[model samples]
Target: MKDYTIHRGVDYRVYESEPTTFYAKCTQYGAGCDWLIRVTKMSRKFCWEIRKYNGSHTCTRATISQDHSKLDSNTVAEAIKPLVEVDPSIRVKSVIAKVQAKFNYTISYRKAWLAKQKAVESIFSGDDLVPNIRVLHRVFWSYYPCIRAFRHCKPIVQVDGTHLYGKYKGCLLVAVSQDGNNNIVLIAFAIVEGETSEAWHFFLSNLRQHVVTRDGVGLISDRHDSIRAAIARSNGAWSPPRAFHMFCIRHIESNFLRKFKAPYLQKLIVNIGYSRTVREYETRYQRLRERVEANTNWLDRILREQYALAFDGGYRWGYMTTNLVECINSVLKGARNLPVTALVKATFYRLNELFTRKRAEAEARINAGHVFSELVTSKLHANQRAAGNIQVSCFD
Candidate 1:
């Protein structure tokens, strides 16, 4: 085996290599050493069998060096696949250390770096990305292009966070939006130590300062205490006229379920949040009031305008949950396994790719003389057709 040869620090020149047969002889075979191996596929068993093998090498290795010809980048990449999968941003120095520990050979930094690159390419490329739902929040940042792109998206933004995995434990915070066509747009993101007030303050401050700079934007998120504290401390940055912070109805439902452990009553609470008119909301609240008197106080504590659609004016834009941002979280399932450096790189790279591709599509549509997105244009045609069917009454 190649591994055997590398471990033994011996050199072999291959004589034959095939699908079912392999033969090699030691480099010093004719001069002194008689080390050789020959293997052939057994017809009946369909397994390679050693037809001939010299006992052992009778001469010293071809040369004494820290590096081995047998241990190339491909071999090292295969060996470090597990490590890279665990933490793609693992340090090159750490890779060298891992190699030295595993093989008793010191590899150069360049070689280790190359192996890591190869491993990352193989893991993150094509259809092999992290394929589950995980979220994190530690800091908040938006690329200049993404920040600029947000200006054209809907006036609402959704934010969320999730836990990080692997050697370093933290949280990833994200803010996302959607275009008229319902494409999820990642606007800002960051990693933080946890969902603490200080962490949120840092992330939100940067988010407002750099990315979400416009006024009258709707900021949707879960009703986490730290987020509340961060908004309260924002001195109107996240307040009325500047911005409006709303709660994700899904989070409210989860909270309701967790607190009362009443699965049956969850629908009533959600109905209260989803009520589209004051009359409908009052009817829903009355229904819930009849069942949950003691448990309803927490519901009343949060302003209806902040969560209930009927009271939100038009700020909610019919979005009832933080699902858009949570969507960004779901795409990050495997990224949490990376180290800070690698995690950051992978996150932005993929998001940037998404942003770039979408931008090109939008530009292409505009060049083709389209003012509204396909979804909006279709809605306009439908509304116009419906209006044509209406009988208008003249006002006195």
Candidate 2:
């Protein structure tokens, strides 16, 4: 019997029992030869056939051929030479072209070029991110930072939801954080069918599972009714462990605007956001109410009812804003119209690109020995220090 090697650029092992079956195996390209091949004779005139010890199918007899010669390792190697050099990239490009041709009539060349460019840019960005397993793991860690088991540290969680458009048209809930330097960091994300209380609950539950501590960590989100309901459901001695939840004031003001349309009241409500005390808020609210009454009593009622609901201290989370989620939503805008798999892949690619840019910026800053805060201050104030008599702290 004689043995032959099967090669298709990728490594593969092949064996045959007899010369005839070996010839058939070579002819079928290993497609029909599943069992080991055993060589019986390798004399001046080699003769061979194949048999399956495990009862696997044998190669077709008609596919076999014979050439009288001594079969050796060299002969088998020679037989496999041409098959090893097939270029996989050429085959891949051919397949891509064929697929593209099908849509050629519907899409213009310029549009096709743009699509290909977008796909490549999305995949090869500097973020050390890829569409496969690596990026998947990165995404998991980004939005779920609590996965890292720090011995004793407060978990910072920021939650917000955004709408996505596509075949499934839904909302994506994202949780993120801020580093000591105040840079936004992603934590975890969930794609839900809708922004209902049930959806928010499911997202929060899944998010909770990824974190180490829930007690001291703070969970921040917009003042959405669904979110409030989810938090309410989380109450009780038997409740899922609670994170000190806070609501973003921006969402509250937007809700107020939607309910109360009086222009003067709208201005007053904006002022309430800048108020330092409850007295200031009440004073502004009354003035706004009187102004609304002068125009229309019905508007006053609507504004008062909405203000009562929004200002309930239970819902406000300091001056926390929804900008982080909004940033992510903007990054996802283009890819939201894709299929689920495509959407996931595109998001990772885009995020990787973002982090890659961030890493580069950080490296550049380090290389220049430039403190980021100083740079920010210089850029904002053109390097002019505030008057000594009236020192200004930016945070204030």
Candidate 3:
């Protein structure tokens, strides 16, 4: 009806309605024009019925305006911004339907698509300035409360990368750390073509120079060739005496399982990785070597200290896995399907929600006189109970 009004230089209004029927009459009825339309709903589907028409209007031309539609790209973008933000996969037809329903104006599918594009750009780029996105590489980076939060967070940082899905092909590289409450805190992110050594170097070089400025920070990640080469090419930026590097023990076990085809070695390898003392690690590792002599060289090739928490000299702080960073990947599962700019904006919105919710929860907990987070308090109690049962020996 809105589309007809805009195109035909006439207006319409609801005349009457029954349970299954709707009647709309043309606004030229005062001039004795009988142009009208009727629709009947049957079993939930609607069918149109042109009830009466005189073909030619008897009304004077002074009352009607033969103007184009008032709905433009900006109007459509503003109308659908909330809908698109909620679900990036929203269909173009849905946008058309929404605009027709809200503003009584039907837009073309092309207009809806263009509106979505404009809205996405408006979201990623602020109203004041457009986003500083590079066209050549299609790379973007974001640092939120991460910069301030990292100053107080532990020095242990985890790095990981996952592939993106959309019209453009790329990978999302992420840096994550844990706050005092053991919450996963995202530090930075980058989108690149793939996990090449050059890409890793670019990500790491920026991370070192801009993101993580603290010296002797610990870095944990999978032993991807690109990551290894990038760290090696860092010219001691990520090397010892400044920043220590370690491999995720879970990734190492995955490789061992894939190559050895021995499910039994899984628990044994995990035990060795989690061992707190060299004696225990040696015992478990020797058993593994004896059971799998043919594949012992594969295990020996990787630096034990990188995967074994017992050999890491407490640098890992009991976290031998990259699960924290993987959690961030899981949180961003939906955003990965969006375009590069939308993906970045989605992360920004998600991080904003996370920070706000956590800050409110922290304040509430503090008001309740809690000195530590619930997890930490519970751990303290459990350790205290265990300490009371220990038998201390004064004589050596």
Candidate 4:
């Protein structure tokens, strides 16, 4: 292979392969070059046959190295991307070892790191991020189409934050919603120094302007002091008559678990948060306070309207936890350890794949004449079965 391409000023990469067959193409393939060749060797004979060949190049004679001694960062990125996607903690030394094993040539550790960095850059270079003075403070978001899709989703949105685990120190803030069929719908994301009041304000301000345009939207989150202050400072944009802010029942329960260390208080506090009526909430709240005085003191420190479902007046839709956003966070856990650009790219590609798969599923279901999603259909079936067992009396 080296002797054949050395005189032609061109390089070839393996295009197709079998036990005794090899097909290759010119390295400058997209640069107006049509040169290609195919070779096959019979098992019985020691000779190879030229099955196909495209004679001579219309493009400039390949002037670069033709021996494949040096590999570009892009090539290295493609080779290691699967590894990175599967395990972001994969070491640079491991990448070099793999490349050496595959190509029989060693790459420097710095080159390997550069290859990973380039791969990440390729993923996120498509989006426009908010300009900033500090390299670590940059914030990025989703495209306009994704932002516009929120109009069709539920009028409720959930916001949450998780820590980044790579070289850069920051937190990932995400705004997500639920579709009519209860699927998690991602709206936007941002990377900030931490979950501070200023960071929350910056993230919320951008989210309000670009994504959460609809009115009467309900927002749910944990009772973080910075988040509370940020919502308050939104100047009515996130307040009543415009949007409602609520707290996650699970977060409150976890905090209560830590503070009071009572295993039994968990259920009562959750019941209070999920109570459908003021009377039921009052009953549960009193029981909780009676069981532990510290629980009452803690409950008093939080806003009743922010957590009590009865006070929320049907805004929560029975979602008393931030599990939707937490699920998304878990899905992105593997990507959290990558560089900033790669982290953003991982999300973009994952979401793209998600949207594509879901759209195809919906189309298939519609083609089958389904009236609602499988979730809704299952609920309907259950209700129909229960209705058959109920007896009705005729009025005189």
Candidate 5:
């Protein structure tokens, strides 16, 4: 009836709107137009049936307004869905123009804006917003293939959070891993209100419950207090036999630089954390100590097992930093500028591209009669050549 009234350019006024009856009549009820309709629900059929119908509208419009009550926000929302899907950032003015073009009527700024909001929500499913948020429903996601690939890869996971840059607010948290061939696989993701402890707790809980299931997994990240607090509340899910938490050396270097304002000692700071043995660690520590004892107090606050490779029980896998997760952030840099739903879709397609290309390359190598990945095959051949130079001594 709303569509019919809008199309026919007729005015209507409802006298009775009830569950059992609907009565509408021409707005010029007494002048000359006798157009009216009364519909009632048949109790037996439970369906609407027209009980009375008068003659066609015999009156024309007295005045035309800039808006139509029949063309409300919900109606306009359905009309502009295609436009919203193509460009979520389309302006409110564009929405008004679209309504003018399609409906032949101009809508108010508030109505056009409301229509666009509805279109975006219907298309993208909306996002969990952050700034000045009162109620939050967090969404944490992990692709199935990526989660399934974790057991086949090395027991290491690097996690990080990057800030979104466009119309949407909040931080994008990602948990990434690598296969034997050093292919970066993004396993899990979430959007949260900055790097708060509660947010990290939500992300990590979903990651552990669904993706990071294997034992002795190495969890690498910066020493953010929120991350530490979240770990402390994990009930040993991220500790000891289950997993080991380690700090990134790059962040340590940045912290040291920030505190002491010394660039010359940054290399030494990295080398100390990169050291694979006690002697190497001591050598690097002494070198830093000799060069500058000036205001470098974070050195005294170091943890060997968390940052130093010499004491990390081989779980670091020779990785001294969260550079891998930073690389993932770089890959998603452009996506950060998109709306929340588009950003998530971008990640899905991005991971699909990576997986598709890598799978093809791996299959090609195997079909060419290689039993291992290119990295493993290269190491095996290098080992074979080195074995000819070895001389065994049998003195027993």
Candidate 6:
């Protein structure tokens, strides 16, 4: 028999046998002990079993062992310490290499790079912490100082939405500026789930809040009915501060041409687009309007209304046309398929690259004692000279 304490100040007499089981008699501590213990073992060591001692002498049992062991929290913490200490950049590269190996036949390096970036992004993404669209928009806006510089200028805000594809497929509305130098600058960007009147209205409302502008700002955009509806909804507060709203001449011409479907009338409409004065525009407009009236009276009325509104003196921005929005759309081409944050980051990077190139070109021109516009004009003139006998007109 081996004596041992089984509970607080309660002593037990333990008995061991060949089967490696121990039996114990409980002794009283404070409460009377009416329990007996049986210890059992199978392979390595003896184990204790406790049971209520019914006078019938049948045993009830619970198992306990002294040699049981498990890895402690400290051991686990130490084992994982090295993995935590490993440089994340190195880990990322290793994971990237493995992914590239697995998909080597299907995807390109650029796509692989984007995938790796997405994976890194996912580690920080979770249900509780999604990326913020506003933060992305701010990152985009920060790249263009020209945008901030002209924030108060009564800018002609042009907006057009285009579909994008990615983790979150949606549409993007881009706000742009035609600065004093005739250069187009991106002002802001937003991504929405769809191109609904409500979405456009919401986007415009947000733009109204973030874009600080002086009174009398002008807005130019395509004649999408949803856009018109959005502008109408914004009549009181988000309305363009100015008394002018301009429609894209190209969009209007396209609309007019669609109804007529006449090659001669299309040529005539193009002439109106290239015309210098209102008198010239009126002459061309009258000619097309008559042909249009002869063909379809209803179509003629619509064309005249749209043409009059678009060509009205207040809407014209210097040249006979304005399509800087098309330039913006082109710049956003490659990035339209990215996630919202990626779209914003890519937009800022691309814009910065564009302006950096432009700045370099401008500095080169200055060093050579020639202005950028002059250099472009001189190049155009040289090209025109080489194409002798052809008349060239400088529209602006």
TM match of model 1 to true structure: 0.64
**Off by more than 4 A, model 4:** 1-78, 81-136, 370-396
Top TM-score model: 3
Model 2, 1-396: lDDT tens digits are: 233222121112354334444422233445765544344453556654333332333555453222212232243223322221221111223323432343221223343334433433333342444466542211222322224422233355667777766445777677766555556666566777777988887777656665534454556577678887887775531132444555454665666667665444555665655555678877776776666555334334333322332343433233346676678677667656554455555556555665678779989989677677768877767535454324555445
Error of 3 at 321 (Å): 1.3
The sequence of per-residue lDDT tens digits that candidate 3 reaches over residues 149-170 is 9998999999999998755688
lDDT digits (tens) for residues 257-293 of candidate 5:
9988889878888888989999998888877878776
Q: List runs of model 1 lying over 4 Å from the truth.
A: 1-33, 36-74, 78-140, 363-396
Clashes of 6: 5
**Candidate 6 TM-score over all chains jointly:** 0.53
Clash count, one per candidate: 12, 17, 0, 0, 0, 5
The TM-score, computed over Cα atoms with residue i paired to residue i, of candidate 3 is 0.67
**Candidate with the greatest lDDT versus the true structure:** 5
Q: Following a full C-alpha superposition, what root-mean-square deviation does model 3 have from the true structure? A: 13.7
Q: Point out the higher-scoring one by TM-score: 3 or 5.
A: 3
C-alpha lDDT of all candidate models, in order: 0.83, 0.50, 0.80, 0.80, 0.85, 0.54
List the candidates' TM-scores in order: 0.64, 0.48, 0.67, 0.64, 0.61, 0.53
In candidate 3, residue 352 scores what lDDT? 85
**Which regions of candidate 3 are displaced past 4 Å?**
1-79, 86-134, 138-140, 366-396
Point out where model 5 deviates above 4 Å.
Answer: 1-122, 125-136, 291-297, 370-396
lDDT string, candidate 4, 111-219, tens digits: 8888876655554443445567355565858766578678889889899999998667789999899888887889999998899999999999999988998788899
> What are the per-residue Cα lDDT tens digits for candidate 6 across 258-322?
76566556556656656666788677767766765664343344433233443454444543334
